[model samples]
Target: MRTDLCGRLGSGDAGRAVTVCGWVDRRREHSEHLAFIDLRDHSGVLQCVVDGARDLRSEYVVRIIGTVTLRPEGTANPALATGEIELQDCEVELLSRAEPPPFPLDERTDVDETLRLRHRYVDLRKSRMQRNLRARAALNRAIRRAMDAQGFVEVETPMLIASTPEGARDFVVPSRKEPGSFYALPQSPQIFKQLTMVGGVDRYYQIARCLRDEDLRADRQFEFSQLDVEASFATRDDVLGFVTRAVAEATVAVAGHDPGTFDRMTWHDAMERYGSDKPDTRFGMELAELTPVFADTEARVFQAPCVKGICLMGGAETLPRSRVDELVATCQRWGAKGLAWMRVVAAGTGGSALDAGVAKFLSAAEGAAVIDALDASPGDMVFLVADERPLVRHVLGLLRLELGRPPVNDGRFNYLWVVDFPLFEALNAEGEPIPSHHPFTMPHEDDLPVLMSGQPLDGEALLGLRSQAYDLVLNGWELGSGSVRIHRRDIQQRIFEVLGIAPDDAQERFGFLLDAFRYGAPPHAGFAVGLDRLGALLVGEENIREVIAFPKTQSGADPLTDAPSPIADTHLQELGLRVLPPA
Candidate 1:
């Protein structure tokens, strides 16, 4: 007999005979003549009543043939959508019996994360996991709709390609057919997507899977998908506008609320105000520079010209001395020399204008100016970090996030365009200057001459040299980044040269793409949004793993399949490989 989903049985079908199939969520014998069982499937749950039944167990795969009956008035469960009606079973058939599960599938079960991952198939049966997965699917659909509507053609790029020694370390695979050679999993479809524009696909997109062998973070995974998109003959504004609307709309459709409009900020402004590029603006305790204030003061605090301060509104008089000390210690741990605190006391009532290690060092006027600059009032506490400018800003920025006060503009989805990132970061331990974003990023036209002149752009000058690049920041997190690519072969080669990439090495590594650029490549720009990260954030989970079906653990091991395992020696031999002894 055909059966219906348990969640499909409802009060609307009262008195109709129905066959429901699902796992028995809970079975209780309410005396010999009455029993109530909660049946559940992916759709939802339903209550089933057995007028005469003796034995039942949790998680039993059962089929119930019954008539839908409304729950008696006042017996309705307000917690469930199907609470108003239940199925009265006249016949029951046990389809499959289940052994006791390692952990209950109930949402309330508090199981260890490691244990849950090991038994992920069972864990996914829980309602929370089900919801996360459903939300992720919806998000994917929304992305496709948005991109397709924008006239983007979905494209697929190769997974195994020549490895380029740039950015993150690659996960390489030995080529059995071509011994002594390897194929690297794509870190991103970066070069290929740009090449698509070269091939004259004006607008291209993909729900592309990317792999990165980098240190894992809450938002990062070894293998993840990104909504990669590129457009020929489009400017940064065009790219940014499309992504902003698409991402905001997708988020609202899946998350049930519009996060609101985005705000644009320069990279410098973000750093100075938030001390982080990806600032979490859910709360405010904005960083304030005290460099100038310190430069003029005789106070020991002034001895450090790079000192910065952040005032916790209304926390001055109430914060305990011990807690203040603890905060200072926290800054030190992050590489600050020390933390300075000033408690704002009433002007006349104050025996001391400022209270802390540096209190005595400040004159009355200098102390008053410091308090006024921060807009301090009685009972407001200000914490200061005295260190290098960047370190001071970094420490204070973290502390601001920790306090979680002053309330960020949570109601608004702040999308920002952080433009003008330095084209090149300093050399690494190997004395190789690394691309701040990547080597292919084109330098600003004006700065091209300066860069080629062999004079480095200082921090301030670097701010003026806008690349054909922009980042989409939503509510303080960088959702994605894209750039108007360097399509001109000469420009691409110049950038490589400035980056110290040898001509032979550049040709060897990216010869295909360079060759493609030679044949009338259109000016193109694109951006990639981390689909997993975006979905997790929309679902309000801390990690992207919540949205992924089969995610690896911190060490990049798949517990479900025990992947990255040892292959047999025979298989290695077939691959023309030999296992090396441990170093």
Candidate 2:
């Protein structure tokens, strides 16, 4: 419809007659006779000179035929890519007219999210949204290319499938034909991709759409996409390599630089050191052990089984007493009995010393030891939690991030492979160990005897068993997880037994998968990367919705379409369903 894009004309195109189409971004009147129009398309905005009689307004779709010429001296806009050139002698053809936008279209305005989502079609026209969507597209393209280069065959999986337990509620589709039967939307292609490995597809990949009936958060939604991959005859390292190469390529395509290599940390170490399986190693307010220092203390508060603290550099100068009190309350809310705080101040000897209302509770030696253990310097603040080991890690871990974690943009990429996850997260009410990843995850080779042993496995023994599972974490976000599959029927059955799933229950839940293995299943492993989270991180968006085209609000409501609306009784009857009144 046009000879060139509005933003594509440059100084080299000077004296060339061109027809460009775009929406008027901004209009500036030079005098009674002349005006400047910033015409915009997806490429960018371009300056166009037109007669004031044209009455071009913001968001007016227009096509123009003009000669591209260098901008007049002292009038060039250095901010724009086409700053050096302007379209002159223009004839404008008005295509579509728009009312004044409900809100500003520029990034400077922080529009209410609900209002923006209500007019998402219009909101997507802003440059930031355009850039984010394009970056996501580029990331997807790069991932596909890298996977193909590594001999993976792209495959499509079913959207509506039978859903077994996957740790999240499923969005089920009722079948009219069967009346009472339902098909659950996939939370992931976890089973289908694994089945592909059993079907002899050596390598398979899919950018699968997944749906989950879970509460929405900044990084989550009812529906999302994952780069799902599975391979037969592959070890855990082999699968990690496949995903790393693809992720590195995608990162380079969107971030413009290789993140280099990912570092490895055991799940146990992550929980102990940073209090999270997905640790953000970008900054240095790490948790410090203080249990030994207080073991012989007379202070009752410091005599707990575990004691840990985090040193916030310069926190003493910034955090007032009221703020420290708030932090203590927050820790109590997070399941701690209480949080202890100490301010590091100059001592009488000119060394660091603790100063707080609670400082008198500790002896001078105890105070000096606390300072030494935390590497406390003057102007530093120390937060300590003394409780059970797990609670201490949990409280201090969150405190560390709350005090020192940088904004997502300032925190550079620090990819980590968290491995050696325990086979069971914990024991259930019946004292049976809960599966960490899944029943199919292979036990560590050395731990096979513990699983196969005829001895009764108690909670401690079960919790100590390690799985061959691994998770890929980026900047404290868990991107995805995978594990080496247990192909042997005996091993799979043994895991099921340990989890208290009787033979009949195991057959009922995963009989198809087990049956498929009987036909000959090769050893396999796989991983999935959340595309929304990855795209958001790459583009410096804190929320995944920024990179999505039409995302539901945090409440899972779509203001644009007003979805989750009512259905007619007639249609409900046809579907053999009835809506009940709210309780």
In every candidate, how many clashes are there?
5, 0
Off by over 4 Å in 2: none
Candidate 2 residue lDDT tens string, 1-583? 8999877779999999999999999999987779999999998888999998888899999999999999889888889899999999999999999999899999899999999999998899999999999999999999999999999999999998997875899999988888878899999888889899988889999999999999999999999999999999999999999999999999999999799989999999999889888898888788888898888989989889999988888989999889998999999999999998888999888999998847888888888888898899999988888999989999899888888778888737888999999999988788988889988999998898988886788889899999999999999888888899899988988888888889999888988888898999999998899999999999899999999999999889999999989988888888889888999
What would the per-residue lDDT of candidate 1 be over residues 178-260, giving only the tens digit for each residue? Answer: 98899999999999999889888899999999998998877788998988999989987788777776787788878887766
Model 2, backbone clash pairs (residues 3+ apart or across chains), number: 0
Q: For every model shown, what is its TM-score relative to the native structure? A: 0.93, 0.98
Instruction: Name the TM-score of candidate 2.
Output: 0.98
Model 1 backbone overlap count: 5
Clashing pairs in 1: 259-413, 262-415, 316-379, 316-380, 316-381
